[model samples]
Target chain A: MNLRRKKLWMTVTLAVLAAAVILIPAPALAANPIERFVMVEASQYAFTPATLHANPGDTVTIELHSADVAHGIYVEGYGVSAEAQPGQPVAFTFVVTESGVFRLRCSITCGALHPFMLGRLTVGPNWTLARAAALAGLAVLAAPLAVRRETA
Target chain B: MNRVSLLQIPWLKAALKNRWPQFTISALLMAGFVFAIVAGLVGTPVGSRNFGIIAVWIAWWAILILAVVPVTGRGWCSVCPIPMAGDFLQRRSLLGPNGGRTRGLNLRLPKLFRNIWWQNAAFALMAIFSAAILTNPRVTALALIIMLVAAIGMSAVFERRSFCKSVCPVGGFIGLYSQVAPLELRVADAAACASCASKACYNGSEAGYGCPWGTFPAGLTRNPACGLCLECLRSCPNDNIVLNLRPFAADLEKPAARLDEAFKAFLMLGAALVYAAVFLGPWGNLKVAALAAGTWPWLGYAAAFLLICLALLPGLFWVAVRLAKRMAPAKPHTARRHDFAQAAAALVPLGLAFWAAFSLSFVFANGSYLLNVLSDPLGWGWDLFGTAGAVWSPLYGSWTVAVQVGVLALGAFGAARVAQRAGARGGLHPLPVSGYSLALTVVMMGLLL
Candidate 1:
């Protein structure tokens, strides 16, 4: 019973640590209190704007549209993810606290070269993190309507 | 299984003994599976890089389930990955009122929520997005850890047999398919059981053990809710309930009636349907949006569920019920319920058939993944065999379609055999309900497989 209780405590501690690791980024990579826009287009497992530049403390929203199949916009260095739709546009938003070059990739299972789907994001000074985030959000909000109008 | 040595078939005797070995292999397998997911996040398996999620799952599950069953009987139930998390909460052994040892302090589930089909539906929901589930390290890690913790906790708190029979999906499959096993535990005498007073099957006394599944040995079939735990083997005084040497695929004399058994059929049917619609269906919209809505998947899934229940299930059931009514015009109405149950039970064979089909697909589809594993044993890349994902590499690739078709036929044969064993007594018009239901399940699986 003591062993089990200990095990349970360990599990809880581990879970908490894991959650912290995921939810809270490093102090250096402090979240941009708010984010702005960063629309990335995905085609044949590659993002259109393969490289992005932004400032720390910015909440960047990424509006993603897939040209071929299902593609996930994943920011590895910052633990960011956005799954893209083939026809419709999908979006994800995250705060950029850490200033560094974050490698992004398509996490969705597209096809042969799905693994090669790559991009880069540089977060540093002169970054209007909140504005970039707002812009990203606005882009996301505007996408569906734009798509609808085009289809209509 | 505790019987005379069979020199004739060494394999069958071994199967009966190892029918269940309290497997911890799955915990290990799950650890590897978890590692794979982490690999996906941090690095990538060059093998699975080009492979579909469905193919990977199919390949792994096929090798595991098929190989495990023939050697271990119903052992997989103990280690099934899907239900391990649910089992902890679903346990019946927790403390409760109106109880000395409460039958179950089990999760007080709703009536509709009781069936295995519900579990199957749950599995379908997971499987549809299993790509993300399998690849995401955080998700996979959480799932594995959850399962490990739940299993250990449930085992510690609950009585033996309570968790496995009721909660796990893999266990559900093991129990359902175990009826096809060659060996079984059965009472030597029904008359002896009626006269005996200290029914060890129920109230297991100090002298003899009781059936943990809450079943009487005399009343038990092969491995219905029985966990193959063998506690009763020690408890019986008369030595009445003996494990018998039966033929291969022997438990066909009766149809099963557990909600667990019923759900597996639904799971198999649902799995086949999901794959077809997702991969081969004419719907272009779902295909296009398959990626975008990964985080929140309920949208597409809700639509799929509606399509299956409101449409496909009804269509199949209607056609089946009609044909059944026609085939067995002479069968009694009481027998019809039994027939319906049996037909539903026949889904076991159909389910197995689909496994074979899926296995065939794995050899073709994910066999590519294996090549990467083979060349890069350490996964260092640069194909040693020079045929990494070389399309024509695997030998089974030659006849995958043919193998699938053959498996479907075998499934039909197996179902007919099961019907006969279930006492269907299929004459020219033995029991139309079973024939039709079995036929429909087979036909649908055949097309889908």
Candidate 2:
């Protein structure tokens, strides 16, 4: 192929791959949404159940139990929080409205690594990771093709 | 791409040539630096609430990684406070050159210890104990004091800015990644520099001191050694020096020719991956092990970290380069060391992007502490800015992940382009390096997202 045709082909291929990655719908897996009762144990700097999974429209009731000191769980994207003492467990319910992964951070200063203490809440499929990976692959494929090879 | 000389602007050139602007900024930052030490020494033990941790790590670090280094190479070094006191002691004057005289024993650094190997070691040491220094206020203060004293001692012993040039952990990575930045300092008329009787840029003049980083401006083809101090601009008699705005990563067209720099690329990339896994991932045991300083677990973590950075990553990259050389239909006599170092240049952009993505998540999540710490630097119930009562809140929660993905994608793309260029120059295939970068990006994505 000529240089112009090769360039055209490369551009078209990249655009198509990007669109397929971004616009393609994820397979529906939540036909029957149910309630998920998850008991999360919070220790010095970690969550017992590091990741929680639920389907869209399903209710997730998280019971936060502090294993050591007073700790709290703040769910990102949901903007809801629950606090628990050493023995006392605090529970909060939120509907899984988002279809991506959100962080669960410690709302209280438990220790030195308080800010780093984290967990994840995955509602349905994590299409964000999938799409991002696919886009990254597309970028890698397209980058070298776009560069002009310098002649000696 | 065309280069626009920022020195063409009269007022900007005048400001840069004058000593007051740089001096004033450095002085103010030095005051803040001292205050951070004091706060760290006496303030509340909570790392989040301490000014030293928040200001230095979160606020200043955010600006340095997200803006300063990416937008203007070595812009932070122009006003960094770490070497200010040392410079003052060495020159005996802050505002001007005292007829280009110096104080103390201005001994030359031994040639064997001249490269960035010391910097690599220093940075590795800091990275090993980063969990402690970044968390404990006392540890942070002591670390700062050690760096300050070391800089002062090095200045007293060796010649111009040797500490920054050869020992500063932060400066090492800054210099490495600064090659990707669009801004650069160079001589506009090379013949003018060649014809000049007095090389005042390296040697001091009445107008300004010599290059503090000990680099000759006329020979500069890359950004690593130049600190962007603009001393050469003032000292040059024929006005040969020009600060130009050029294409990003313009320096990467030519691969690095040193093994130390290649190792630096690997070290930084590996550090980023380790930090992502330890600090941001959902692995609690890893965090505990990293935080438990002096314990066996911490030792294990440190050893593993060192192995990954110094051995595993570089070993894997070397294998990839060797494989590429064997596969390529080029001269079989190409030097193995040359091929490896050249191909390793491809990791520079990817390493920078990894740091940016990691800093984005860390700073965005913890940036709110800046307000609280600013108001109450000592955490002594003082609300100087009325934000002491502000609550902890992560900013742009889910959007941060999206931005991280975008940044990583861009970084991967840049790395691929650089790999192709390096391959073209080194008579090797670009696929292995590109594949390595892609695999790391996927792992980074997995750790982060």
Candidate 3:
């Protein structure tokens, strides 16, 4: 390959790798779909149904309730939040257009394990996992190539 | 090795020469420290609202990770209140020179506990309970008070700053990561140090006391042990002591890596990974197991934590080293153990970066509480600053992932470069070592990002 072509290819490859690294997270998107309600219970350092699944364009209404003290749900990447006092259900709805794994954490100062209170939400066809794997592969392959290039 | 000596600057020299500035900063920190302990004991149980938790875990941690350790090596140690209390009690005066007389027993630190092994163990013990400690105001206060008492007790029974040098859990990692800090303290002229008959930097002088952490400034090549107390700067009659502003990771080029130090790097990287998984990862059962202390699940969790930190990560790293050895063009006289040690040292920069990246999520996401808790220290409906009712808002939100990736990449590249250097020093090929580091970097990126 010519020097210019080689440089172009290298730039393209690096751009793709960068994209793969940053592809795991996304904000909520506008989509019309049947709304599905998810009833989630937050206890001491845990959330019921720790893993929730949804289709790409599905609207998710999460009714968050604290089994113990006051708690709040802060969904990662969606910018959706709700506060739930004990026995009081707080409903938050958002359209899930991001096809990736996101975390829902207790936002309130709940207890000693407040920081650890977490749950996972997986949108269908999780591209984040595939992109992460691709990133890893790119690292493994590119490391040797860079080393050789330096030595050369 | 090129350095810009701070003492060369007239204003900086004048400022450092005076004890009042250092004393004032130390006193302020001491007051804050006392307030944290009091707030933890008597304040609200809520971690976010409590001043102790918000200030110590959120605000102080943010500064420590994002500013202090990266920019200044052991700068926090210079003004640390923990050792201030011990030093004051031992010297019998805050500003006066020890005059070759320490009030404490002044017994030597145990020969077996001389190296950083005790520190590593203490850090591991703290890591095990870190989840609880980070969120509980009472627990956090108790831990600080215990350390304070321990520091005082150690000063009374043992020698100077033994708690900091040999026992403090937080100090261990601070010391480890301080190697990467840009600022360093050293004697400017080696010949001057050699010619001087009175090594007042190590011993005491009329101007200042001896090195509190037992470090002789002349032989200082690294920032790991030297608690930058600035006593050496004051005590040196030859004026040999120089604080230099330099590049980061200047001390990572060890001729021979100590096993304890290498293991410290491993522990730091491993613990960062584990903490990321438990605190940030989408796993509820793991968090539950981590929280339930003394239970069967908790024991299992503890075992797994220890295994990952002590065995699995080190074992994987050893395999990487072995593979590097096999792939590299072998040098006839080189010892495998020595090469292994060198390879581990190369990971120090990456380890520090891993910590920084992990800490970003911690400090940024939860850091907003600093405002709320500052205004209402005890969460007792007292809005001193009118910002007590401030809403909890995480800054930069999802952009943190990108920042973390960038930081990790920087660290990974640094580690690769260091590995290449080590490879050249040992007459080996750099490819495999760099490859191993890249693999580890990808793993960290996957975990955090």
Candidate 4:
């Protein structure tokens, strides 16, 4: 194959692989939502604040940081995962519509306890649209403060 | 019977030569990897953990061992330590003392018996044991120890590459599949080889070892016994040795010469077939119990299975060899063993398809539980880590099956092309109908799986 063709094929391959690893469905909601500014600490095998809960139609932007080592946060159902390194936080946003609790697990084998490490989020009956709107305002305002602290 | 010659592909030729060092290093690097796996099995707890990691490991091993190794030919063998261990133990002097003379207690064996059957036997032995312990920590440990012992034992007796050429399942795998690998090492100038005299490549030297597999470098034109060791490359004064970057599956052929290589290919096909039957077949329950029980009766049954899988199949190959001889166009009485060997090459693709079918179910059956297991083990609160919504994800299985089927199809097509090319040289007609049937078989396997 020629150089151009090789590059084109390689790009195509990478794109496909990326799609396989990262494709997920958007959350279903009834307009009003819970907005949560969440921080997740990932390690070699486990992630802290592993279980996350929010009302129906809640939106979450998780600021993920690694405490000890490299870990991949792969959510199989959602098809979203982020690579977490020590002290470096990654951002990922997702909304869950299913009212039941969803299980979460580390995709990477980080340490000895990798097998036992797990957490889950319990979505409750108290979820409402008005409260979610208020939470969204807090989230927009809070991100700037976090960025300012980061710069400082 | 790959009838094609890929020598005309110049870019491939250059790419092969340029990438030699990387492949050489990678070969040796793989030995270290085997060591790490052994170490992990020995030191880590014997408990079963998450299934996802197991799936990944299994998939990685399959891709690397079955698909990758076989296609690349003696590329892996060049650096495989299984042979090196035997060479070291058997050869007293590491640096070929007495000017690389073949003068010592470790005498070279007869040329006729230096085929891949012995190695096939060894590989089969491992497969029997692997039935249960392939996934287990203790079994993997025992398996590694056995390999170490084999290396030590073979080196004590054989002159060079006794374990690698004669034994080692992984070696057999690579040798068989390597016919399909795009990269190959070969002679730069056949004319140079024809004219040259020292024969330093086949015979030893003070500088480096000879072709341990007993391949006379001057005579070799294809990639069967050539270990990609580059010893001959350096030893050759003719400047004839060079690695070829060629179309994959270029060497699948029906030969009139190189009898041992023909047998080795058959042995490889047989191994692939048996591996599928044992690993993927419905009899897995009995296979598992037979090993873990560890009684004499169980051992006997397991041994019987091994015999049927490895030895019986090779025996059938020899029979096929005889049958293939009659099928040859011109000569029936003196049909070459090489022809039989080339036909054996067709077995690779069929076996590959079987493996893909077997592994696909695990993608759906076992994947979700692994994702679920992580939350409790390391106390990660993330719900997919513990997420209830993550349960019953079936795409992982379907995607894996698709990938495997693709690999299988490619392998089948390549094998058929090479077989057809080789068969044509012997004046045999191409088996396009048979090829189509095999292709359909592979497709059906994916759809069914």
lDDT of each: 0.51, 0.90, 0.79, 0.52
Order the candidates by DockQ, highest first — what do you get?
2, 3, 4, 1
Best of the candidates, lDDT: 2
Report i-RMS for every model.
23.1, 1.0, 3.3, 21.7
Q: Model 1 TM-score?
A: 0.56
- Tens digits of lDDT, candidate 2, B1-449: 67999989999999999989998999999999998899999999999999999989999899999999999979999999999888989899887776568897999998977899999999999999999888898899998999999999999999999999999999999999999999999999888888988889988889789889889888999999999998999999999999999988999989677889988998899999999999988889999999999999999999999999999999999998987887787855767888888888889999999999999988998899988998899989999989998998888576788789999998999899998888877888888989999999999998888
lDDT of 2 at B39: 92
Native contacts kept, each candidate = 0.00, 0.77, 0.32, 0.00
lDDT of 4 at A52: 69
Summing lDDT over every window of 10 consecutive residues in candidate 2 chain B, give the lowest-scoring window: B326-335
**lDDT tens readout by residue for model 4, B114-215:** 666666667656655654454454555566567768766765655666666666666665666566666666676677777767677777565456777778
lDDT of 3 at B117: 88
User: Over 4 Å off in model 4, which ranges?
Assistant: A1-152, B1-41, B44-60, B85-104, B110-112, B256-287, B293-342, B352-397, B422-448
Rank ordering of all candidates by lDDT, starting from the highest:
2, 3, 4, 1
Better of 2 and 3 by TM-score: 2
Which stretches of candidate 2 lie above 4 Å from their native place?
A: A149-152
lDDT string for model 1 (B267-356, tens) is: 556665555444333233333344344434546664675566345754564456446656653554544444445556555665666665
